[model samples]
Each structure stands twice: as C-alpha cells, then as structure tokens.
Target: MALKETRRPSIFWLMAWVCFGLLGGSVKFRVAHPERIPERGAFVIAPNHYSEIDPVIVGMMLYRLGRIPRFLTKASLFKIPVVGWFLRRSGQVPVERAGSAAAKGPSPLAAAREIARAERIVVVYPEGTLTRDPDMWPMRGKNGAARIALEQGIPVIPVAHWGTQALMGRYAKKINLLRRHPIDFAIGKPVDLSEFEGKPIDQHLLADATEKIMGAITAELEKLRGDKAPAHRWDPSLHGQSETGRIEP
Candidate 1:
C-alpha cells in the first residue's frame, strides 16, 4: 500500500525515485517485517547508521514500502553547491550537526515543526551520524528523533539494517558495485512513549525516549544478525571520539 501523495515536488520525487531505484537494483535487498511501516499519518523512521550509503539504501526501502522518505541531513552537506541546492529543493530538512535546527531556520523548534507540517515519513538517525562503535553496533543516541516525535506528537518507527557496510564500508569513498551485496532491513513497531507522555520535555526525558528508539532498532537488528548487541552502548564522549567525523583510534 503506497502512501498518499508526498509533499515534495513532483520533479524531486521522480528524481530521487529514479536515482535510488538504480542504486537499489545494484544491491540485493532482503527485507523483513515491512508491515511495521505506518500506512497513514506522519511518523518518524529511525534507523541505525553505519555507512555513507545508508541514506540511499534506507530511502529506497522506505519508498518501496510505499512512503516517500524525507531525511534530516546535516547542514554541512546542504552547503555543497549543487548538492546543497538539490537537498533544499527536494524537501529534506537541514539540521545542525550539533543536533539543532539549521541556522537558516533559526529556531530549535523550527525543524521538527516543518517536518510535522509535511506529514511524510521523516528518517532521523538517533545517533546523529555514523556509528562510532568499533564493531559498528549502535552507539548512544542523540535526542533529535525523540524530540521531533514528542514535540510533534508523532510516533517514532525503529528500523535496523545490515549490509550497507558491505556495499560501501564505513567511511569508504566508493561503493562496490562489482558484486551484489545482500542488504537486510527489519522494521519494528513504533516505540511506545506513552509513559513519557505529558512529562516536561527535558534532556532526561528526551534521552530516555531516544534510548527506547535505539533499543527497538537494535532489537530488530539482532534478528538480522542473529546475535546480541553489546551490553553497553558505545559512548563517543567516553571514547574521546568526535561525534560527526571519522575518528581513528
């Protein structure tokens, strides 16, 4: 069941559909639990981050699930000339790498507000960037996704995926198309935030909600990888690693 018309322009919708479609054909996708995607209304699709190509892979998966996905991408990526122009025009939201709305929008509340206004499936990386874990397991999450869902009264859908790293390794500059990498995606039920409902939206509440979202994603990932995640989630601060860049230990 495809979603109703997207808020993005027809041209961009077609462009992204074609671009990601070609990329999608290059890789073999094994998806589980596609039914978890919401058929109606606006919702957040939170996924684990591991590779540079994840956005393309996840966007294609969501589109196939019948929702045209809009991403919460870093502001810096939106500054790269033609790429930036396309990002802005394609209806993607520009967010500060520091985890706030971009300066152009100028309000902490502005990004989520615009996303809610669009009423489309918005993909937010709870970690805010590629995973810093040595094993590429999910690390501690940023509160952006939770903030959007809680403030906008929308649900956050957790998704776990694997094999993008094989298609293009973490921090790799080139995608290997010589062989078809089998990528897997598993969508989980929307995180239950009923307990946090009506609470003061503070750092603590947002962190807790973000963990809930991450946990849901990790759980689905375990199904694909057939193993358990580490008992402790990787903490960038504890490891003295930068949150937004490649940090070599």
Candidate 2:
C-alpha cells in the first residue's frame, strides 16, 4: 500500500517531546522491524497493552518513524485539563464506553475509520486496556481492531512490547525509576486478513481475526522475552475480572 499524504498538527510534536522527556531518561527503548510500519498509509497499529506508559513508549516509536500516532482514547479523558487539550488538538479519537449516558457523540470506531481512511496510522490496544494476565502476556482482544481492518480493508500491524511493566506496574500509582529498564518493541508484518476481507463481518469472523492479531503479538513477545506464553490465553471473565481489563481483588 502506498503511504498517504497528511499533515500533522504542531500538537503532535508537542506531545512527542513531552513523552520523550518523560520516558527517555528512565528506560532504554528499542524498536525492531519499525520498517514494517507503513510510511504513508492508513493501517491499524495494534500493540499489547500492559502498562499506562505503553502509549507513551509506542507513541515515541511511531513519532520517530515519522508517523503521527493517533489513538482511540477514552472519551472521559478528553474532559481533563491539559491532557484533554493535548489529546484533542493532536487528533486523537475519543471512544465512549458501553452504556455510558455521557457518551453523546459519534462512535469512536467511526472516528477511527475516518482517521484510517485519511491514510494515517491509528494506534489501537486490541486488549482494550492493560493486560490482566498476571504474566503480562496479551489477553483475548476485543473485536474493534479486527472489525476496522475487515470493514475498512486496511492492514493491521501487530506490535509486541515488553519491559514497560517493569518501569511501571499495571495500575500502580507510582513509577519505579530506580533502574533503567529496556523497553523492547517487536513489530510484526501486517496480519493476513485478506481471506476475511470480503467476508461478512460477523461475531465468528471478528473473533477469528482478533485471535490472529493477538497471536502474532504473542509470538513476537515470546521472541522478545524468550519465554513461553500460557497454554491458553486468559479471559478476564473466567478469572473473575471485569471487561474493563481490571483484575478484581
């Protein structure tokens, strides 16, 4: 696919520097196969979510690649002061959670489709939120990315990252910068959803495609960590967790 031509607002660079300053000193970051990221086209950049810092790390990676990282953020975040201003000004899309009366607006997925159609990169956490897996491996993903890929006919690039958890544990209120952690990112080739492209977008189809996306991410994570993933992916529901990606105490 040819790269699309688009203009990134100044806020994108502003956020880039902010993220860099925040993370640069604390961790050694490396990205593999960054070339796999399409230089000029609309594609889904799906990465496993394990920490609050994942976006900052991944955003830096994409920014360095000359792609403006547009995220599908939670709508509530857009209500914050400085953070919200940055998210909206930088072209990030806001998504409302299910059954929230405050979610009065266009669907976030729809906004994502618009961004992709413009030939821009859209970063999506297929896991939806941070991984609930105690081992930090990616859990079963939602169908949002899969549906977008199939419905929009855009590519879905699976990226696996490790070490962010060490920098900041999941949902922990404080960050540990006691030691410099190495944040490793492995970018896989675009998932082959060609077979499902023309098929009807259904629950079964979305589930199947989402599995492939998460599977690719897991495979790369295994390479980065040199560790084996669980025999079966974890489902938060079965583990007494909520769909919000939180592990219940």
Clashing pairs in 1: none
- Model 2 residue 173 CA deviation (Å) reads 1.1
Best by TM-score: 2
**lDDT per model vs. reference:** 0.82, 0.85
lDDT tens digits by residue: candidate 2, 1-249? 222322434877677777777777888878898789887778999999988878978887777777788988888888999989989988898877777543686686898899989888898889888888888899999999999888888999999998888888888778887888898999999999887877778999999999999999999999999999998998988977888845642
Q: How close is each model in CA RMSD to the real structure? A: 2.6, 2.5
**Clash counts for the predictions, in order:** 0, 2
lDDT of 1 by residue, 158-179 (tens): 9999999888898888988777
Each prediction's TM-score versus the true structure: 0.90, 0.92
